[model samples]
Target: MMKRFKTAAALMTAGAMVLSMAACGSSSKPAETAQTTEAAASSAAETGKAEATEAKKEDGAKFKIGVLQLVQHPALDKANEGFVKALDDAGLSYEIDQQNASGDQSACQTIASGLVANQNDLILAIATPAAQAVAGQTSDIPILVTAVTDPEDAGLVEDNKKPGTNVSGTSDLTPVKEQIDLLRRVLPEAKTVGVMYSSAESNSVLQAALAKEACEANGLTYLDVTVSNSNEISDVVNSLVGKVDAIYCPTDNMIAAGMATVSMVANENRIPVICGEEGMVDAGGLATYGIDYYQLGYMTGKQAVEILRDGKNVSEMPIGYLDQEKCALKVNEETAKSLGLDPAAVK
Candidate 1:
C-alpha cells in the first residue's frame, strides 16, 4: 500500500534509468543501474513514511469543544451530559470546556464570548438563548444546539431543513397535541387549561402557541400566564388556580427551574399540570407525553461528531428531530395520588 504512493519523480527516474541501461547493452553496467533504481525506491519510501506519520499525528490531535448551557435545570443538565457522553462513546480525543450561564442572559453573553475567544473547534449550546448568544459571536465555528424548540423561530438559523449558517442540531419540540390529549385523558371533565411559561423564552412561546391550537381543537378553553422570571412562578400558578381546571407547562427553562413551586401551588388546588418533558413531570407535574432531553442531546452530539470528526458542513446540515417513538407518557404517581387521581388510571 505504501509503495503505491511512491513519488512520481522517483518512479519516472527509475524507469528512465532502466531504459537507458537496456539501450546501452544488456550486460553493460547492470549492477550500477540496479543500484540507481534501488536508491530511488528507498528515497520514495522515506517520503511516503514521513507523509503518513504527519497524517497520523493530525488525526490524533485533540479537539477543543466548549459548552454554553443556558441554565442548570434537569432538562438542560441532561442535555449537557448527553452531548459529552456521545463524544466519549465515539472514542474521539477532545478537551471540553463546560460553562453555565446560570439562567442569566448577561451571563450567557459573557460565557459565549469567552468560548469563542478560546477558539474551540466546536461549541454546543444547550438551549435557544445559549445558541443565540454563541451564534452572535462567530459564523465560522460549528454550533450544535439541543433542548431548543424551533431554531428558525429563535432566529438561530434561516431554515430548519437547511440552516444556511454555522448552526444546526436536534430540536426538543415535544408533542403538544399529544400532551394536551394526555391532560384530557387524565381529566375528562376538564374544560379549561392554563398555559404557563416564561415570557423571555422563545421556545416556550412557540410551544405555548401550539398548545393553544391543540386546546382549541380539543374543545377546551385556554388561558395563558406569562412570567418574566422564575421568582414569579408561584404567583403565576396562584393566579391560574381559580381560572383554569388544569395547567399546561411547556419545556421552558425558567418554568422548569421553578417547577417545585408550580407543583406546590397547582397540586394544592387539585389542578393537574401537564408538562412538555419528563423532567418537569418528575419535578412534580402530573403528566406529559414528552421527548427525552438526554436522547435529544445525544442526537445533537452525533451531529457534532459528523461536523468535527467527519467534516460535515454545519450550514448544510438539516435540523434533527426526535421521532414520536422516542416520546412517551410520564406521570408522577405521587402527584397523581395527591390530586385524588389513580396513578395507573391516568395512563
Candidate 2:
C-alpha cells in the first residue's frame, strides 16, 4: 500500500510540472505577437505622415508666368505694367520671367522654347511674332497676346469672337476710318495723304492698306513710303515731305522708335503730321484719335484676372476692346501751331 502511494505522488508532481511549462510557453507567445503588431502600426503611421507632407507642399506652390515681348517700346511697356499690376491685385503671387527678342523672330522662338521647357503656367506674348512663336511651341499652354492689331490677320487665331485655340488677348487696333475722317476735319484743304511705315511690320502693312482704302473713300490721294529699318525712316520721310499735303504715321514700332527724327523733319518743313496713338502725338504729331495705352493695359489686366481667378478658359474668352472712355482725341498744340493750325478747332 505504501509503494502505491509513492508512485501516485510522483505522477501528481509530473502533472504539475507539465502545467507550469505550458503556461510559460503561452505567455511567451502573447509577448511575441504584441511586438509584431507594434512594428506594423509604426510603419503605417510613418507612411501616412509622408503622404500628408507631400500634399501640403503641393497646395502651397506658387504659379509661374512667362512674359515674352517682341521689343521694348513705351506702348508695350505700359501693357506689361498693367498685366503685372492686375496679377498683383488678384492676391496671387507669381514669378515673372521676362524676355526680349530685340525685334528678331528667331530670338523670339528661342525664348518661347525655353519658357515652355521650364513649364510656365501661362505665357503673355506682347506682339504678333512673339505670340506666333509661343503658339508654335505648345498647344496645351495658355497664351495671351497684347499690342496685336488683328489677331486673325496675325494668324494667332481664326476669329476674335471665338479664338478656337489656346490663345486670346487685347487688340491695339483703333478705328482707321474714323482717324481718316479726323484728318479731313482737321485739315480740310489737304488733298493728298502720305503714309510712312516699316515694310517688315505686319501691323504696319495692315494699317497702310486700311489707310489707302479710307483715303480712296474720302476722295483723297494716298502715297505709301515703306522703310525696311530705322536707318531709312529719315530718307523715306524726306522723300514724301513735299509730295503729300500731310504725313500719316501709324503705330509702327520702328517709326515710333525714331519719332524724333521724323518729327524734326516734318516740323521743319511745315508739313502737318497725323499719328495713330497718343504717345506719337506727344512726341510731335499734330493729332491722334485712338485708345489710351494705360487704359488698354488696365483692361488687359482685368482680362488676366478673369483668366487666373475665375478659372475661365482663355480660349473661350473673346478678345476685349477698350471702352470709349478709354478712347480719346489728343492733339499737340505746338505741332499744330507749327503747321499754322489751331488745336481748338479740332477739340
List the candidates' TM-scores in order. 0.83, 0.79
Summarize candidate 2's per-residue lDDT along 62-92 as a digit string, tens digits.
6668999888777777888888887777776
Stretches of model 1 off by over 4 angstroms after superposition: 1-59
lDDT of 1 by residue, 1-347 (tens): 56766787689999999999888876657888999999999889657634543454477977788999998888999988888888888987888998989999999999999999997878999989999999999986789999889999999999999999999998998899988988887899999999998888999999999999999999999988899988888888888877899999999999998899999999999999999888888899999998878888888888888877776789999999989876888889999999999988998
* Alpha carbon deviation, residue 214, candidate 1 (Å): 0.7
Poorest stretch of ten by lDDT in candidate 1: 48-57
Candidate lDDT values, in order: 0.88, 0.82
Q: Residue 268 error for model 2, in Å?
A: 1.5
